[model samples]
Target: MSMSLRRRSGHGARLGAAGLLTFAALAGTGAAHADVAAPRALPAGCSGTSPITCHYAVAPGNYDVTVSLGGAASAGQTEMWVEARRLMLPATRTAAGSVATYSFTVNVRQPEGQPTGQGGTGNPGLNIRFTGSNPQVSAVSVKPAPQPLVAYLAGDSTVCDQPSAPYTGWGQVITTAVRPGAVIANYADSGESSGSFLSNAALFPALLSKIRANDPVFIQLGHNDKQTSASAYRNNLDTMISRVRAKGGVPVLVTPPVRRLFDGNRLTPTALHVNGVGVNLPAEMRAVGTAQRVPVIDLTAKSKALVESLGTSASAQLFLRSSVDGVTDNTHFSQYGATRIGELLLQGIREQRLSLAAYLR
Candidate 1:
């Protein structure tokens, strides 16, 4: 089953395949054959004037999606989302009156409206978003995609996918590093500690329920866990590991990324001082991984090393900064920085020789 819509300045409405066939012929392409649904146009409500998002109903399965952009000007970009998660697409640019096509394979889970405990924002389905001046989408095609191994990321803001520009997380950028046949579902959120994540009704349970056997759940915490006792934080990690294991999922521990805190000429330690003693959060994470016998990604050490190598002025470019906000945040990452950190995470995955490495691009 398929439906299409067209968005114009003052009008928009659902269209049938006949309209899509006309569009295909206009683009000098033949009609779609069996097994390939005709391309769908954006609903009229999705005006081309501003950034518009449109949703399409889809079954709970993997799909290969192809988006054809027509009428693009000098430069433009598009971001595609399956449900709430972003799918990585290569950058595309076109000249006046030209067309550019991008493709990706995504695993679509049941929409949030379903009985799944992973409910959050928006209906469960496919979402297409176009951003930029004169952004135009000519056609969108989705077909059943091959089932691929999945990986889940659970942590704090540092690992989550930030919604807008100037604010990016490693999770969003890491998708580019993941080769075909593997998908990443980042469940990380801001202000979430190890305990809060497990306790959150929508986050961890949703991940646990969907994870299949042998799939890896990458767990990272410590930034917010600093508020709690070291032992308690470790306990939370252990609990998460055990629960994932109970579901036949592989649990991989990841120490949180280092904060860009510089003290004079050296990087500051991420140790929290409690009761006259300093508790090293990353060390605690490593200890927990050892005790639980789970492979740990020592991102703390890796990130700190990266920052020290870049120095103060240069490394500052990695964090969130804006003249308007007048706030320099060391905890979060800008797009460039997030991409670098994402690469580092990829390196860790490769270093450990995790099964997921087979899917790295």
Candidate 2:
């Protein structure tokens, strides 16, 4: 069985594979070959019949994707490319690859939607490690990673899906209260992870290209980074920071937001368990900041402090006021939440004394 879903754009209708797709599942299944719309979809410029197939689109931002392979898509190796959403990937797929699982990442690009940047890991919508026995797109567990200020939240649905939902992450809100020129490019996808986000082919590259000499790229990971350790969030963070610094962008680290966990009526940050450790990351963050010589925001600490002040009951007030989507979401933010976190980031910038502080009001 196969499944395919196209997230329709607000202004566009359902787009067919502008070319042809040889409907094959990602499992490298040796089953009969036939184009199945469920698992395979193609975009412009792809031959649609070759071993290296591409699904390109001109849209920007993040996306969640599932890729499967049928007989032909499986027997022969395959190379994939998601055109508009940036990052880096092999120009083609090989027969040695597994096809059972779906690939998810936050695709990024230039304002006009073109690929730009050093295609590395943590890009959305452009990767999957197909070990022969690995089941398709299965995430046994997920946790947050060491996050920093100036979050570049990039993933599928887990990203800024709504102005109100921070269960995904709160980069948007974290960016707002800062001075007007500060950059908070929330490119995270709701369903993306370190493995896939790095391979998206467009977005990551664009992010790299977009880096200015003084830009600080804060990463709020773990929500998805923990889902796939093969891509190792810590290592990725280390590498991403190096890249950002190499490109002249300051790299701040952040820990994932704590879950809405309460302990016998007390709001506890310890509930977001990671190897018996929680995600409230001030210690780890402070070290990373000192080691990397970049400022750390410690939003997790501040948020935890705020929760402590609000108490377990009032803690709910930090989230967005829901409409039909339910109210008081914790994982994400509302305008109010985003605003608060954004202010925290601005404060972090000031404390760090980055020359860029002049940009923050």
Candidate 3:
């Protein structure tokens, strides 16, 4: 199902796919197609769709999106995602006969969203998708944002927006923990290391082109850097920092989060991200942060404390277990685990007093 819209002034005035997406343009693009709505009951552009997708064709840049949720006929719950699967809003419930309005910034680019480094990823234009038990999108307003801060994420699968549900990354949900005015554009991909991410033309090079003045580029790796030497890892990080600085972007280092590996109540060294070559990866990240004068979010230490405090049985909820996600994965995070890690990242932002901290929700 699809519809078209007429471009407006300002943003829409710019060249190529730039415009506001009203209710008329919202459609269902998911597996379950939408039920065509009655004129009076649903908004003109919206369909009574479980997974309603609204796409705004616009020039690559940041956009301010406002969504009015809930229905007059029945109570509803909704989860909003943009670009790829970056969770913009967590599941929210609204009562019947009421509308809850929400606004957030989104960074739109050509590849559309983060490519997982694996094939078959990304969508075209500024895509806003809604899904949940009952998703009621009454109205939507998309406008070009003027110079909002953009937080770019770079790392591996644990930090990338997993193309599928149930398996998520912290970067995908971090936007939910932040206030408006700041948008997160995750470039992290699966099986990426510091070395590979920097050298990849489609990843780091693309990120550098988008860096605005004072933009914060958060780098987290080590999950796939198992064989990288300490000196090489540091060098990769230093090069990234230097390039970001040249572009007037502030580079922040982030150690990888710990795996849910436990040994009798304490996390094993491997769980703590000690590489195959006997390098303490997180410690090395901290050292680089110090030498480069960059703020480092010690996610390894923070996640270690949380995992250890929760212990074996409880901490299992922090990762994808076989029963939950149909796969026993110790490294990747489940939705709950991803949210928890996102919270830890928020805490780190506040602790380090990074400029992005000022926008934390």
Candidate 4:
């Protein structure tokens, strides 16, 4: 199969092996089957109600999937995933009696090592969840393609996909900036560091097992690693880089984004002090990148520049405010801030001319 794939828009008709799969609403009928083709109605379980999750069983391979929404004048958002791995799609909003479409390519790999039966054995699939008011899913389509160049994100909460509104992560918004052929698999989670991510039983192992040769793994740690010794932190990064390289993967080091700690007019180090160690973590990441010969995305400096340029009162907009999360947090970002950071990362990828750039939309 050719690695190249094209996205088509419009209503209903199926195209080819790689065409649209229209879904019908559940009519209080029987259950939905796995192998059912296009123009099939949604199962009895999935309805037009807000905040409903639907699953589909698909053959294990790489696919370019597109989801379309219709009905209602209200706005809504939907998220798609291949099991735990998230697929990037724009927030869907439609006018009264109009339709909205969002599309992205994803690699659906069979479970390696342990068969958790998350998506069932041998047969892998996609999961879609609708959020917001009056959300309704109209259709979904999938086309087979050659293995995609996957860019996997491994880091902390700042890089993970935020589940709800008011809080968002750069990883979640990056899909919109990425070109069609490449897919991003965000494995980052809240409160994760280099050490914890590798030891977290499922995270690192799952990423390593599915990652193919030439896949790029973007790693950003250091927020939670502050508790860990500098030596230990560097070693953990080294080990991760080595492991990724051993698998024929490319490891790109990303310094953690800066916290919104300000000293009067100037940005200051984050107030997260432990054991009297308040060194600049980005410097450490830079040193590791130099030593390991891996490309580095200096998100720390870029975020700091952005914050400093915005000044104190104005910079607050970039972070989670007390009004939204009930607490002022400089460590995490708001949706606007997350989108900016994601754009910065995408710029870095392009500037570096990484192989993944070829797939950028």
Candidate 5:
């Protein structure tokens, strides 16, 4: 009935009671209860319009999710008055020829005292069933409450919007590991920054226009912040952060990616970075953030460590393919490698020890 169901309000979760939320870590296993996405929004079939809340989500698999109405002697049968139609989804998210199954649930309720809505009468409920290959297996379930949000990411080129193609920055890594659903949105561009992201006459303002309360902003710059220590690009960190905070948005800063180069003795993060690849920027950005008392995501340091761990031979697979002209492929990541970084980002979230694991689905 309400966004916060009083009964499902507690943080505690039931393993098989049709409502346990699971946030997928690197494993990308079955999604958690809270982190799972709702099937879709449709007209309510339940009679009356008293604002009922639906608890439903599908985990990763090929599923045959179905909904039907029924009731027990203790109560009435679930009526379809309020529900326009029961949803039935076919297999998705798994291998095509492989047999698999998926499941989801819908919970209906009234706040007691309000006029009953469709399916709100008695203890009437919908019975969701599944039948496919391997009908019986180990699975988890739980109902989850909405999460409180407190951060946002805003940047350009390397740390902004997640480009669908032409492999680019690692910003998506942060979001993939930290939360799911509406928890994060990337507003970065391939060649934007504090100034260009804001002014560019056609950029900045439009991006910041949609941010809301407690939604912290994360900034990553260096390649474009310029090498100078006091350029408007570099100097604006605090001012930009303050302006964001004044608007009730928290602010975070991230270092740029390390240049894909090898020192005579070891990996040199600060080397030739063409193709607008902003290597070493994140590392430098992290420094200013430390002094400013702002949170910092050391992607540069972390990425450097990742490259070092994989070694240049194995790590090169993560970067864009090198064509003649070097293809300007200095900082961007490959898809397979991007997933790996996403896994690491989740580890970072855990290391930071924030209350964000609940959003992992």
Candidate 6:
């Protein structure tokens, strides 16, 4: 769906002194009963609407985080994203003088801190970001997690953690669906075909080296695999599944989401993810899943149903349209669309009876 976009820089708007006072007062008042106590004076950097980032210089690893949401004088709504824009919380609305506490696990690494993706480097530590109509933060806590169910994602741009706004990937938003004790490490990068993922040192090799027993490795490619032969595509997927199995990890196949291409009321074969050589990539992935006895999340089918149901014009909200971002990207998703896809992924996990489903929020 994309090549790597620019990484988010540390520079962003900051809250004014009065705004800080408002946050401090609201945060202090809510500290008594909250699980993660709010600081009497919230450190600077919390912004109003633009993303406010707070970085903790910690080593690369999984950390359990608890955040107290809401501190604005009036009602506020907020969303949280960790390193590389991994959505840990969706838009949460809070009334005036109210605080909502949420906890989740985040995997932080060096360079970009993201599980995978080559892009602008990340600062050394954990970066917690807040963004929404009226973003707010009362308190924040980070503790190294002893162990957490790590869900590893591997795929193309459609499934990677998109670095910027408007153009979102399902992997970036799926973290919001799970609670603590589970962390999603997205290694999926833009422009990666199945073969490239398997061969890329920064991708599959790094992912394989980190796999623990019972870990779920979700693989979804095909957006860039359009030129790959059917046999090679299937073989690459099989090899990836086998490698995960060899590492005592479980492999789950996810079909690539459909493009926003439509012909009249129905979608065209190309939009449905048929390859340049006339192969249905999703169907091939399904065949591999069946042959390997791996669970397959049919995102292609699910997304197709969703897009066709909405039809051409209405479905623009499900993608990055020029109206919103000054650019129409039929392949990439907006935040709302990514959130929906994340929900669909959660549903697929439940349907497959994945152990990770137990930790979903």
> What are the RMSDs of all candidates, in order?
10.5, 17.4, 9.2, 9.1, 14.2, 8.9
Question: Mind giving the per-residue lDDT tens digits that candidate 6 earns over 172-211?
Answer: 8767656578888888888888998899888899999999
> Candidates' TM-scores?
0.75, 0.50, 0.86, 0.74, 0.54, 0.85
By TM-score, the better pick of 1 and 4 is 1
C-alpha lDDT of residue 157 in model 3:
89
Candidate 3 lDDT, 1-361, residue by residue in tens: 0011111211111112322121212222111222333222444444548788777777878888877776446667788888768777667666666666667788787665455336354655788888988888877988898889999999888888787877888888777655458888888888888898998888999889989899999999899988999999999999999999999999999999999887899999999989999999899999999988999999999999999999999898879888878998889999879878877787788778999976654
Give one digit per residue, the lDDT tens place, for model 5 in 1-361.
0011011222322333322222221111222222122222222332222222232333311122223211111111121111112212211122212212223322222210011121222223332322222121122233331333534445544443332444644444433222222344444555655565555533335335545675656676555655434435446676677777677666777666565687643576354222233433454456567777777766666767877877766777767666522554756666445545544544455455434434443
Q: Worst ten-residue run, lDDT, model 6?
A: 1-10
**What is the alpha-carbon RMSD of candidate 3 to the true structure?**
9.2
Give a tens-digit lDDT track for model 4, residues 7-98. 34422222234211111111111111123122334443355465656666767556776665554344334444334333354344444444
* Model 1 ranges with Cα > 4 A deviation: 1-54, 59-62, 69-87, 94-101, 107-120, 132-138, 144-146, 271-277, 324-326
lDDT of 1 by residue, 73-161 (tens): 33344443444435354233334455555455565654321222222445566665665444556667777767678898897777775
Candidate 4: clashing pairs of residues: 18-143, 24-41, 24-42, 179-360, 179-361
Which candidate should be chosen as best, given TM-score against the real structure?
3
- Report lDDT (Cα) of residue 197, candidate 1: 88
lDDT of the candidates, in the order given: 0.64, 0.42, 0.77, 0.64, 0.41, 0.76
